[model samples]
Target: MSLDAPYIARAAKPGQFVQIRCNDSFEPLLRRPFSIHRVKGEGSRVKDIEILYEVVGKGTEILAGKKEGDFIDVLGPLGNGFILPRTTNHERRTTNSEPRAIIIAGGIGAAPLVYLAEELTKKKIKTIILIGAKTKNLILCEKDFKKATPEVYISTDDGTYGSQGFVSKLFHKILKTTESKFETIVYVCGPHGMLKCIVDICQERKFECHASLEEKMACGIGVCLGCAVKTKSGIKLACKDGPVFNASELIW
Candidate 1:
């Protein structure tokens, strides 16, 4: 048996995420947000969508142990806009040139990055991915991302695999060393602290940045109002409004 959700695939976008209720009952009550990793099949007949997750606590631990056929309740394709450059309706400008993008993932954050990378490739945008984990085993989908982007960098805090440092450290180094201004957009997903640090760096360096946030969510939709983040505009629900937001807009 395989887990299935037909509606989600139709609605998902890069940088958006879903909230999944893993248990049969409401003991856990809240749904957990996971980045839409990738779409597995084609068209209206999509077989499944992949979601990358880490076993951090009760919710994710249960999800991690699920068998292939297991069914889980999920709500999503939630969030605000993705990082795609806005095209104005007034301007009928079209260009063959592809936009360049950089994706940074920390630990399980790589889950969403994988899906976003695939989407960027389909749009013919150039992509680069940098992922970090404690060790090589924790690094997910290195080969898959390599297929989507010409450049892929992996870093492990323990030096057991790729570069030996935090993922942000590698990102700063790349920003400093790269001669070509090939990077126009930056997307990041990770722990709150990590995300905050990256957002700060982007702000200081004047880079366009979007970040996926993690929070305790009671309802996957807007009904619960449990997962709220303070933004420049006001409070926004992470489930309905975003698991993703412009780095500058967040109060973090």
Candidate 2:
């Protein structure tokens, strides 16, 4: 859904999200958090922001039924965002070769990465995206990602899509076969099991990695401490301290 929130659109960074009030009734007291799917506008003029969501619960079901031109309450551009690689931090194999970025998304997790991939393309970085779904119809953002980068891979667990296998398994094979000469970074957003597996692979490969954590938030702000994650440093709030965190920083 596209929302006419100009300031939120302008300020939103890749991996950042927004808290939306699903309905006016107090039945569902808390607002739901959604990643900023994409920003819509032209040069320096951000008209609106988009949100990609699944109707997994009553809140999202209510949101899904809202018509266009309706005013929805939204609290914006929240949480820490992804850090882009510049020349100083990222390694380059050769003077002419650019740094490579590998993005792994499972199901609706692909939502946030579309914005990131577009930004990466604008920086002229080589970006490859791997999207996983249960079936061919469950895949998200293939066309949007293709517009951003040509190198997009798809995997479905049911053998109904591009590749027939778990996406994590495919990712491991790719990492194992990749040459050490190329500098690569990975970004992932998915199920806990998938995230943990990918984190292990990245750790073993010694690749810089970041992950967008999907957690339930009671209070979108940090107050309730509802969305706490155990990190290497200490306990951190997912709603405020992250949603996006460096993979190394997480205990998992």
Q: How many pairs of residues in model 2 come into backbone collision?
A: 0
Q: Model 2: which residue pairs collide?
A: none
lDDT of 1 by residue, 125-173 (tens): 7777988888989898898899998789889999999899888888888
The reply for model 2, stretches above 4 Å from the true place, is 88-97, 176-179
What TM-score do all the candidates reach, one by one?
Answer: 0.87, 0.94
- For candidate 2, the lDDT comes to 0.89
Q: What is each predicted model's overall lDDT from 0 to 1?
A: 0.78, 0.89
Candidate 2's error at 13, in angstroms? 0.2
**Cα TM-score of candidate 1:** 0.87
CA RMSD per model (angstroms): 3.0, 2.1
Which ranges of candidate 1 are over 4 A from the true structure?
Answer: 86-98
What's the residue-level lDDT of 31 in candidate 2? 96
